[model samples]
Target: MEDLLGSYIIFLILLFVETKGIPPVTLAIIILNMFIFLSPALGVGEVCLSVSTTLYGCEWQRLALAPLHHIDLDHLGFNMASLVWKGSRLERRIGSARFTFSICSFGLLTGLTYLLIKATLSFLLSDRFNLDCAVGFSGILFALKVINNGHSCDGNIPGPFHIKKRDACWAELVLIHLLSPRSSFVGHLAGILVGLAYVMGPLRMMINWITGKETSSVRFAECCQLSRNGHPDRDSDGDCQSTCLPRHRRQRRRC
Candidate 1:
């Protein structure tokens, strides 16, 4: 990951200097990436290649693990710096739990998208490099850029190049591929597509619906627990019909 992606790394490092409120889930992911990278037991062969049809068999679990492993300290640093930058914005805006769900879901989708892209390339054009393996958080970082930009498209993605928020992810993909000829081009492309898919609609709705349901379940469970203790959901207006969270502000601002 060099050139445009590398420039982003520098920009993100400078951008990440302000780490005021790095959320819990984001912190866990940064820690996990570091642990995975530093541990000799989890080397590249063990945690690499989310999917490579011509090489390793599809284990499925690797899809989640690959994003947590990086090739080197610089790679890890760039991604973690980015995680801190983007994760702070996203987790604060959407809350940690929902952010966690979004990461896992979009991460897997990005891996699968990589698989589909490789398969299509190999089948349609017989691209030999489709069998290669790639490992890093860059793919998911691209997706986070999508969500991040969608939430606040007030300006351009700052770096050496001036790119509007709406087109920044794609612009980075092409530029990185062009400038860093050895980079994981298809993998990066897959990430941008996954990001577009998310911002365009389906993924966002699914995450929101799932998290909302989980929150409601917890609220109900808390209400039941209180009832067992000779108390129940006591609303401000004396009507518990609104549930335990008072029906309005129990969740984060995203609520």
Candidate 2:
């Protein structure tokens, strides 16, 4: 309960600094999660992520929904805090449409990764790992963290452990699992693996192909120009070239 309250405080602080209020993609996700958490009618537990249940019982919808479900208030709180940071930043850095597709794909892939690893371990170890379920948005957060840091310098992250900014999220995943026995160690590890796969794998290409969307490189460049020129207001028509300098001049300035 205390942790949940602290998360709310942190969330409010994040809202203050965020250039844009909650991006639509992130807002929709938060609302969905809140509804699931507050309404006993939702029954997230019945569909939570469990390897045995997923494979044997064939509850495939759990793969998509489990990441939205939290184990408890603290679990939900911590994940939401991370979500506000990573979601807002990444969604802004890339367009909101891309950000939504990326997270949805990551969540699905993360669940698949966990299921595969659990099945392998169960087959080889013969009763070592538990068939119990896992649930949280932490996996998607880790993937977003990887994507965010992959694109920019994340700066010196403050911590006693002193991990590099790019590597801090991975370190935090390990630390969180180690500190809390009840936390899903395998689930978090699966998230990291899935994150790596999403960044390095052809999943991105597949996304582009399916969505028929071009890379955000040009859009991002235009947005930077708009901000630099003190015209941060985005045109509702979606054309970023509004009130912007010519391409050659912008290139020359860069050179």
Candidate 3:
């Protein structure tokens, strides 16, 4: 438990440093590589599940908790490095707190979704197939990429970047096909849906509610108005003069 807490603290520290403009990818890759190398020397094999079972005396039932216990120092280092870079860039643009929250929330959501899908599949295939425990950071990475691709805008404007959404989605689809050919497409699809939901669902609502501003194409015009006039504040005539006067008041002013 102390080791687990320590590892998490290190991750947070790395994340903080990454947000401050330090590139942490190389460090992550190094850590993961070390784990890969040491696992064999430690007689635990390359499979993380074996190491966890040997070290902690846990069963396959605890696979879901493996990520918390088994620190694939190398794989996770590399994964966190990439995510930190990507997430930090996004964070810089969107503000650190919001970006951090988005990444953590999306990761948790993806992890839960992966677990549910794996559990259901395991139950369904109990008679025919024996599924081994699987653990990795791939799902979270995929989710982040999907959300970033889908929700990205061209300099805070909308429409022109809409085409990129389709392109990004297709790129991920192709990559999944090439990489995890035998993997269930449902999991990937779920990740994509979850990514989209993070953008268009809860994250969007939370940001809007907290910042009192819209962050979607559907509300682009409204956002423009708010930006121009300042939100939650009205002009003398009760018109949002930041962008334009209200329709009724325009007529009244003319009269």
User: Which candidate's lDDT is highest?
Assistant: 2
Give the per-residue Cα lDDT of candidate 3 at 63: 36
* 1-255 per-residue lDDT for model 1 (tens digits): 356555754655565565654678987887677666656566677766633532347577778777887877777787788788778867776677877888898888888888777777777886664666788899988888776666552345557777776787788788877886767887788888888787676776677688773343222223322455666544432223334445335543322
Q: Which pairs clash in model 3?
A: 28-77, 28-78, 31-74, 32-73, 32-74, 32-75, 228-242, 229-242
Sort order, TM-score high to low: 2, 1, 3
lDDT of 1 at 122: 72
Score candidate 1 by TM-score against the native. Answer: 0.72
TM-score for each model: 0.72, 0.77, 0.48
- Candidate 2 residue lDDT tens string, 1-255: 666656776775677466457788887787778678767454656877876789878989889878878877878777876787788877775688888788888898889888888888888886444376888898788888776655442245666766765687678787887798888777887878776765574776787787765445433333334356655434442334333435424564641
lDDT of 1: 0.68
Name every residue pair that clashes in candidate 2: none
The 0-to-1 C-alpha lDDT of every candidate, in the order given, reads 0.68, 0.70, 0.47
Q: Quick one: how many clashes does candidate 3 have?
A: 8
| lDDT, residue 161, model 3 | 46
